[model samples]
Target: MSDRRATVVRDLVRRLLDDADGAGTAPIVQVGHPVLRAAAFPCDGQLDDADLAQLVALMQRTMRAAPGVGLAAPQIGIPLALAVVEDPGVDDAEVARVRERDRLPFRVLVNPAYEPVGEDRVGFYEGCLSVVGYQAVVARPRSVRLRAHDASGAVVDEVVTGWAARIVQHEMDHLRGTLYLDRAEMRSLSATDRLGAHWASQPVPLEASRALGFALPTPAGPGGAAPR
Candidate 1:
């Protein structure tokens, strides 16, 4: 880590320790926070096992409490390259078919990186814990090859597809100081309540994409393979 990044990590450690006693969720830093804009420092074994484990646990708790699929360190105001992801698994058959979501065991990623596995893309409504209260139509690669370390510093390398891949990309972008809105159809952005009220049933609305001057993927047949 650079001197500046080291300083940032030191400050983060102090802040985390100060709040260690607090109850409830860790405060998620919002869009305009400087920490969210700056590229996070690579963990690179800088944090000892105990501290690393504690931080990962805190992040997992915060993410579950938020009821979100993923969380990145920057979202909780830590400028470190770390993230946690889990999906209790989607139960609705239709929802599951559309999203290709499945049960994902809780996993930790440190100093992570990913690359698109194919030209295929899936466009869907995505919201963020940090962004809060809005959802937008953003398209991302449907599969990715990931490389990272577990909380114990063990190497992790795998290919992930479907909803899990989207979660990975979203969280990784946080560490890179990017947001879904940066790649979303701005005109298709909608309030959370409004989405549930009017757009919840549609996988991807054609009218919304037309209004936003973009085309979304055409749905494959029932039980068909994911959009390519």
Candidate 2:
């Protein structure tokens, strides 16, 4: 059924994009959509090679256009276990160092999953394209072991750390029908403007936690500090 459904979805998305005023992108579905709340269908050979490539290309274009670090299929009204992630990085060396954020090349993840590598946790402000206009602080594992198939159906298994790990975990959560807000410290939610205006200077979110009157998990191991 998923395989047949994949064909239907691919055709539907193409038509939707065609009608999107030649922008070559589709509208990202916002939060509260049923598709975003349901577990996505696994992408195990559901799409043939050509169809898979086309879908990946469209997803990449949409993700780049949204100007987000990552995007999951459910975010676009396609409930498939797929996502694209990339980060060009910030120019400020101090900020990058504090957040452990570096240049991350664009990559496609199919049926991706991850597990925490250790007990250490770090809290940082996170926002989703689906949950537009808001950002919140969430604590997550500082390192994780990622297991997935690449665009070419090759296995990918490795340990990712720092900001990269955070990106992986966030996207994988979408495949499992979860959102950042589900795990977020609710009190720390802030409007996008307020986040930049009030908490942008605080790198690790510690100050926001303090000001917001919320508790943050302590770093349990090395390289674990308050990150931007």
Candidate 3:
């Protein structure tokens, strides 16, 4: 993230938190933003600042509000070198053992750089919040290596396979100003013609209750709300 944009986000988030009216929310620039076109600012030095902290907070709230599992700084029009990933814990050992393979645990990468280490593989059905109404099938590596600086600025190199690897690669692309659309072989805006299923699906909510916190059709029934 550029120091300039980071500074802006820090101030902006403070304003939003104080009022909480939601009027001070930052606008996510669409595909037309000049910042999205070319280069993403690199972290010049230590990322210790209010902006970095604010980015993390804003990203979390934005992701939750938008109902997405992961969100990056660039998506919100702040070109930062960080991303926030809320892990949906899955039984990885069972998944990997089923196929006789190994996969790493979930991680939150900051300033990550992805490089192919082994056989190359491609993927599709990537959805971007910036292109909200569209879904694109892009091809990226099936296995990859990542190098990044930790919160303390210590260099750490990691490796992984399968979807976990894909997540890092996808986020790293954002840090470089490249969207999955750039690498997509096929693109569509929600299964207009040739319909296909997405490899990764968005998380679905289980249920929604009203403001009164009562189950539907349950004022005095078996499923009625108990005394608080």
Candidate 4:
């Protein structure tokens, strides 16, 4: 969130916008990019409705193609306080019941922020489109109150629970240049491909913690199981 980083993000945004011409998917910015570490500019009045709509559509398309549940503007090199999220969910009833993950409709969040709703938290292996190929266990609040504006500039204020809340927090962190790794349990970090071979059966990080020889921070009381 340094001034230099912010300046770099702004320059990148301008360059990306200038070059946008109904082209193919905008390449997702990778983990080491300076723009990904910079706080984003607020979306208010930055683009007219038409441009904003176009940009949101582009983001949605890119996110869907990535097959990810959420995407932040900075992930695509446009450091604006905007993101898109959606989760069609998996068909496994057991996994869904444990993770508290259900289907979430697509949503566009502009200048979104979240507040932890309670003391309860859950640790789950989380991944990011920007930080592709790796996953790690990060503890997040079980629920949150989200405040933001939708694509139409309408106010959005709601309390989301379980997996939906996690998605919100993950995307909101991007606006502040915060990646999940910033709050992850480093010992539990694993390559995406190795998850099925090692940690897929463990509903929580406890087993992984024991296997990896690292202490897993226990959540406050019981709330929900870990992510898949």
Q: Which candidate's TM-score is highest? A: 2
Local accuracy of candidate 4 as per-residue lDDT tens digits, 13-67: 5566556666546789899999789898887565667667777887888899888
Worst 10 residues of 4 by lDDT: 219-228
- lDDT of candidate 2? 0.83
Q: How much lDDT does each candidate structure score?
A: 0.82, 0.83, 0.54, 0.82
lDDT at 39 for candidate 3? 53
Candidate 2 all-Cα RMSD:
2.3
State the weakest 10-residue window (summed lDDT) of model 3: 203-212
The per-residue C-alpha lDDT of model 3 at residue 143 equals 68
Q: Which 10-residue span in candidate 2 carries the lowest summed lDDT?
A: 219-228
Q: Sort the predicted structures by TM-score, highest score first.
A: 2, 1, 4, 3
- State TM-scores per candidate: 0.89, 0.92, 0.64, 0.88
Tens digit of per-residue lDDT, candidate 1, span 1-228: 876767668667656855865444678888889988888888875666766777887888889998899999999888889999999977677778768788889999999999998677778889999888999888788889999998877899999988899899999999999999998878779999988887777655555666556656545433222343
Instruction: List where candidate 4 sits over 4 angstroms from the true fold.
Output: 1-23, 217-228
Candidate closer to the true structure by TM-score (higher is better), 1 or 3: 1
What shift in Å separates residue 117 of candidate 3 from its native position after superposition? 1.8
